[model samples]
Target: MRLTRCSGRSCLSWLSTIALTLLAGSTLTAGIALDLQDPNSIKAAASTCAYNLLTFYTGNNTGDVPGNLPAPYYWWEAGAMFGILIDYYYYTNDSQYNDLVTQGMLWQVGPDDDYMTPNQTKTEGNDDQGFWGMAAMSAAEQKYPDPPSGKPQWLALAQAVFNDQASRWDNQYCNGGLRWQIFTFNTGYDYKNSISNGCFFNLGARLALYTGNDTYAQWAEKTFNWTQAVSLMDQNYHFYDGAHTTLNCSDINRVQWTYNAGVFLLGASVMYNYVKCSNVEESDTRTDSLLSQTNGSALWLERVEGILNASSIFFATNPPNVMYEVACEPPNTCDTDNYSFKAYLARWLVASIKYAPFIQTTVMPWVQASATAAALQCSGGTNGQMCGMKWTQGSTWDGTQGVGQQMGALSVIQANLIDQVSVPVTNKTGGTSQGNAGAGGGGGVSTSDPALSQNAITQGSRAGAGVLTCLVLISVIGCSWWMIA
Candidate 1:
């Protein structure tokens, strides 16, 4: 049974709805759904959602996919939508969306390749660029076919974004971390946010593994350590929102977000695998020595496991083991930026399993149950296929449909497939086995520093490092069932 955290009117209304549906003898299986073990079924669901995204969100220009909020279009959500499409491409190995990815990303980068454009104003936040940068990195990781003819290589574009992000790093605040915004007047400019730092950390980890470069690895470790040092992430492995540099970086925000944890979780897994798979003994040089040190230390890997277990416990629910935001759920309090929170959580849960093979038994139940509920909520909207913002409320749509909603739903569906088919084949870089599109081109600046590398070591693991056995609850969400794989 689904347990909600809301009370009074909202809770009563939701309960009445659930009661009415049960009285009608109606189960949640109305539209198409997938079995978690069947790759074909997962692909079919993802393909339908992929088409739904293009149908509802695509504008006159492919790059003009609008955000749910005002400003008509925002780079961050658009970048997130792009990431969803990239997920579809990777999971299904379908090339149809390749052109869409190419056109959408290329149109946003200006002549300088810094992602600054007249259509885009006040959009220079490191996190904003990091969102699109992560998508570009995904494309690069998948080796999405190069843009037709004269376009920049996919990996090069990602590097340009990363170069710009690295330039935003400020040591003046909290020892070291990227500021939330580049412009002084923008809200949260002086305040660092988890998503900003998490995105940068994730990008650094991915680029390090992708390029086999020590410099990016150093940057990733540095970002991870800074967050830890500033108390942005606590002893319990719970990630807080951010801290204010203006207050001498005191006064922690203490707000935790699902996406923030999700990004860093995935990044940590990448770092773990990077250490695990690298040839640390290849040479006795400084880089090799550093890699060897990181590899021998299980600290990062253990932290990844801790965060996964903590997330499963803190974000718990019972509609067949569904995971909720805890903070935003039971009340439907999620705003525009929060709409896609659960998708990020689901994406990385599956990624951690696929890449590092670290604690699938702990993370898989959440993915399975959440994916089931997410699919059940998709059959009630106008098109008979739109997904809602809250998956825990019930099987009814919340009358919301946009890039955020579609993306949130589509990613959960895509990630669920990984558990069904098998772990995706990944290279030494801990990415899916795909050819590189090409190397990055412009905005190239080395992030390498001897002092930075020397100071990059992470703290040792703390308590609660024991493995968590996966929780399995076999119940019906729809007309589907599965054995834990």
Candidate 2:
């Protein structure tokens, strides 16, 4: 159903379409029929996409799991795929993919187990290492099942990656920022990119959260400030592509990607939750500033919230709510590398809601609408289902199948585990069931990161008058939840 502007009747029509989509059973694997609010449905959808990864990957042993892409494993994309699998472990607590995750990460560690120089090399940029490092850190945070006897522990691998990335922090260009490429021979070695620094900040925040280490928190703050100081991230929290050192690192790439926003948001959220003040002391005066504000409002919270609002508001102006590739997808010129961009957005959106529940009222509607459109845009593929790049309602798949599309759709579906809305219901006995109370909007409940515990709603309640601004943008029509196919 096409949106005819934001009128009440049009909102009702959209709700009707969503209602029809949800009535289709949650098990439908071909296209839609995915209940984004149900854990079982999320697990099924994630399993389907994860199983599909093997088709593109070539490896027999555990270490070779994320092996070379049939054409040599692209570091960034493959790293993200590894992360999706790890997130699945965290979301569902099913250790089925533990070995794969462990082996895949172990395979990347150098002889010293530090990822400074991974076994494989296309271009060993700080950004590339940071991607893999973030994945390893995610595993460490989860204590991912385990590889095998004598293998490096997930924590050790992550620390090694952090140690290596920190060593490359050059103060020459922008006081402190990691270069895009580490190898002098690489073309962009002199460029300081958002991904590199964002990865560093993310890794530091996660490490700080998991290990309770203040150094990691310090690194997180410093890296975020460097990105801001250097103008890689603007005041509105709009992240530019990269800045070159040739011009005193003053030239901005002017391109915006969702993943950049995702990483920084998740990183800041992590810091906000774990690091109360710059000093991780129990009696620090600065800690008072943290508890007084809302969740995710301390440290990098303000900036994180800024980026989240800016991205959702400005990224996709045409469809109003859908998040699009601002630089590439608009022109139908997004290449394979751009395919997986939205997946990161999906990942961090859920992360933001998890660590910073106060933002749930702000981000829930956008998440619901986008995830619904993604599921609706899926088409039957050789392996059950494939989602397209453009996720407008009722749009057909572009006949494209690769890691990017698979990851993008998988991330969105997986995020449902965290951001799902339950509608209020009445039982046969005339009692109101405390179920999810939303279809067009969320329950406005905020939960802690799944890494904390399986069931921990840190804070959840009705959106008060203060959130009217967020509520204004959401079309609340008393909609019902659905699992569309």
Candidate 3:
């Protein structure tokens, strides 16, 4: 999606074609051919992602949580991986990524990352523990067994990740809940963000379902109950900003982040399928009120749907030719100053939109490409536009920005998978909000903080790094019906 605008033509030639084919007053196509997947784009995005994940091993992973982007941190990247794999399948359903997942599963030892290691402390502060673990677990256990060879190695990785996260449940928070992390980005370094904790809980729920383990599911129930009581957002949503970060509770604001919010929904939807009465653990009678057998927590799913609904703003208001935004309704343009957030939000949002089509359906060619172009405009290379991100005013082209932009590459292709499914996820919604969302020019003003009023990132540094050029791993396996466990 972000790789090739002309398939093989040079960027200048391609840009010329764009100009000739599109005019300012010319209405953009409302519906794209659902078969919009591009093999070159898929390969490019997957390859770049491998490098981005590799950065997590070093101290280079950006944003606030420094050393916790890749392995040895968490599995919140399940959606991230889904973004990549969906692109792979859509473009050319290659089984090679599954091979990588299998290889990743085989290497699920401490040396591989932090698979065998326990949390340095009893709290869930172990960043990569659940993030990568969940992605690898889901791919290996459920997804990778498509060829029908019972994957013992993948099963073991899933089991191992479950064990490690479970060990962290000494479980005392500001209230009676599982303490996920004792750290914060804005202020002091000891608080848990709901995004991370929700990811952790969701991972646990996924593992329980994978192994058919009552203990794991029981634990998942407890965490969800705690989340409902504490992190429930806007009275109607299930997401939370943080457990309780600031005095005014303004810090833990709306459940706005797209990838972050998807964790909760994926967990609930996946967990809802398997949460039958099990005598796994009876330590406390406090049941996970959201997981029921006969009927799902209507409110819980509705909240999840509502959260996805907020994400559609990416499509509604933003220029159909632009990429994604960091916040759905950011106070100002600076909120999207971070390049990677712009990239991954679109990727993750697309993953949720497509996978949970009940939440969002329909394929808008112009909308999808707008996001890819905005991101490519940021990246700006033969692959994309090869531009850098606008992360703070002075700091330019850091590792964090690169990490985030790769997410866009991931989403551009992921959405291509379900593009053929013509029905809109919800007929009640339209892409009206995306009209003014992702405008060009880095950012001229700051809606949240005047301090974020940095100018836009220039197009010169749209330097595509070495990894962006080629991702060679690919084994085309026919897409068959699900080989359910």
TM-score of each: 0.80, 0.76, 0.56
Give the TM-score (vs. native) of candidate 2: 0.76
Show where candidate 3 strays beyond 4 Å.
Answer: 1-91, 95-108, 111-124, 145-152, 180-189, 244-255, 272-293, 297-300, 313-316, 320-323, 327-356, 362-401, 419-485
What are the lDDT scores of the predictions, listed in order?
A: 0.65, 0.62, 0.40
Residue 16 error for model 2, in Å? 9.6
Top lDDT prediction, candidate number: 1
lDDT of 3 at 54: 39
The window of 10 residues in a row where model 3 has the poorest summed lDDT is 463-472
Model 3 clashes, total count: 56
User: In each prediction, how many residue pairs overlap at the backbone (N, C-alpha, C within less than 3 A)?
Assistant: 1, 13, 56
Task: Encode model 1's per-residue lDDT on 1-485: one tens digit a residue.
Answer: 66769899888767655532232222256434666667777788778778777765554354444332234446677777777787788788877876766677777776765565446546567788788778777776655555665666556666667666666678776777878887787787888878899998998787666655555667788788888888888888889988888985788988777888889988887776666545543333564333657433377667787677667643444443566667676666877777777777777777766555646777766666666666766775667887776666456766777656667778877886664443322233234322222222322443444465333221121111111111213111111111222
Query: Candidate 2, residue 421: CA error in Å?
Result: 14
Candidate 2 — which residues are off by over 4 angstroms? 1-30, 61-66, 117-119, 277-299, 313-320, 393-395, 419-485
- Tens-digit lDDT string for candidate 3 (161-224): 5544444443334443433453333233345556556656676665444443334555566666
Task: Give the C-alpha lDDT of model 1.
Answer: 0.65
How big is the positional error of residue 256 in model 2, measured in Å on the Cα after superposition? 0.2
For model 2, the local distance difference test gives: 0.62
